[model samples]
Target: MSSLWEYANPLKFMRTTDWLLPIVAVAAVVVTTTGLIWGFFFTPDDFRQGSTVKIVFLHVPAALMAINAWLMMLVASLVWLIRRHHVSALAARAAAPVGAVMTVIGLITGAVWGQPMWGTWWAWDPRLTSFLILFLFYLGYIAMWSAIDDPDTGADLTAVLCLVGSVFAVLSRYAANFWNQGLHQGASLSVAPGTRMDWAYKAPLYTCMVGFGLIFLALVLTGTRTEIRARRMKALAARERMA
Candidate 1:
């Protein structure tokens, strides 16, 4: 009957993660390797895009995570703002770099995919533009946290920044649907049977998505543990200096 919030304690969180991190990390590696092998090798090429279509396994997953990681941070930021949980704040901080990397991967892969298809490497497409802006917001969020010395104050400011950046996150996900003029296609793995991917492509794509999600979870856990230890060390150093 212990409440979930009990894990908010730094010591408890560390203990839980110590056991949990390795499992998630190993699963991430196994699943990601399996999905990539299945996707890149076993799968046949698309009739139109040919070999380039394989890139979707990576691009789609990264793009999805890029937006999802921001959503995770937004939720964590809210928890910190309302509950004043240090762990929540640190989790949000940890996710920024991961989310930023996902955004970069999405952008790069999209450009690579677009060059032949769209006759250009870049475009002012609404989704692409909004995704780029989300990346910038990630950078600003990370920088704002580093610039402020007080953890609580920094968390407060960054929480507000997260709220602001969420607008772009929403736009990034739905801009293609809103503006039909864009080069980007609709969801590759939609629930609608008509729009969903073929079984050959969809199967491995789903696997890759799960793998990427596991990888993100493992990374955030690792980052949160490091941040917690660093905070502990800093507090100890300050106490020694005061003594």
Candidate 2:
């Protein structure tokens, strides 16, 4: 356990991420570019939805990351609370904007797809409403962090908010299934036999999902590094003032 905690040391964390970032960044660029191009051009249009169906390549992946990013933050927050790990707290902080961006992308793409399929750009459907709520949670989490000047205090406040918001996030994920009447379609990918999405659409979509996840990791690592540098600068400035 103590050895595992060694990774929480800022110097160790920075040394590891310095090497890992470039590789993750390159992979994110290559894989995401490939997946987006393949999905947009190579894949056939849906019989019913036509060209607009291509938006799923963007929408679904962003939506998946939107939820997963918050989940990641929640876990990071828990680690910070339990272990007093600075890296974990900063990781949760670094993830907020990325998650917010993903949520916005998901919502925008969803709206665009909906206009053609559902005959409206916006609705109070369960899925849409829950997702909006999730976005608001992201905003709130970010706001809470910014509102507090003390880093530790900010982390504590936001971590509590994240824990509370997680309930709603989980609700957002299962809302469509529970309601069963939303215009939004059900899950595209599944593990059960014969229920999975067709490979024609699924292949590029899954690739994009992986790419998005990698991109999220890359962004978090970059942002966490920046936070660490800023904290070090602040501490140095304080020490200089004392001297």
Candidate 3:
């Protein structure tokens, strides 16, 4: 447990991720390409939705990452607040943009899917509404971090914001279940006895999910490394001025 905190050192974290980043990047490219190609070309179209179902290949994974990214940030925030870990705070900072991009992808793909299926581009349904709220939270988190000049103060404020925003993020995830009447469908991937998706779609969908997860990991690592370097540069500049 004590050893784990050693990674909170920025220089150590940068050195470790240097090798890791390229591996993750290559894996992300290969897996994402394979999954998207397989899902798009090989998978059978849905009898009900037809080719529009192909959009699911992008939507589901993005939505999953969108929610999971916030969860990751929330956990990182807690770690920073409790342990005063610089790496944890920077990790939370690094994850925000990736999460925001994922949220945008989810929202846009969902709108595309909705237009064909629900006959409207946008709906005020509980699921959609909550997701929008989640996006707003992401925006607010990013903005809060940028608004403050002091790194420590920014970290503290954003960590608290991340904590508070987590409640809404949980609510967003369960909104579909809570409001069954919403136009949005239920879980597409489940391990339950009776699953809605067939293996034909499920296989590639899972693959894409894995691919997106890897992509998220790669992006976070790269962003965290960049943040570390920027902080180091800032510290050096401060010292030079003091001299």
Model-by-model lDDT, in order?
0.92, 0.92, 0.91
Q: If ranked by lDDT, best first, what sequence of candidates would result? A: 1, 2, 3
Better of 2 and 3 by lDDT: 2
The C-alpha local distance difference test score for the whole of candidate 1 amounts to 0.92
Clash count per candidate:
0, 0, 0
Q: Give the clashing pairs for model 3.
A: none
| Top lDDT hit | 1
RMSD of 2: 1.5
Give the distance in Å from residue 120's predicted Cα in candidate 3 to where it truly belongs: 0.9
Q: List the residue pairs that clash in candidate 2.
A: none
Report the CA-based lDDT of candidate 3 relative to the real structure.
0.91
Where model 2 places Cα greater than 4 Å from the true spot, the runs are: 1-4
Please list the residue runs of candidate 3 whose C-alpha ends up more than 4 Å from where it truly belongs after superposition. Answer: none
Off by over 4 Å in 1: none
The positional error of residue 32 in candidate 1, measured at the CA in angstroms, is 0.6
- RMSD for each of the candidates: 1.1, 1.5, 1.3
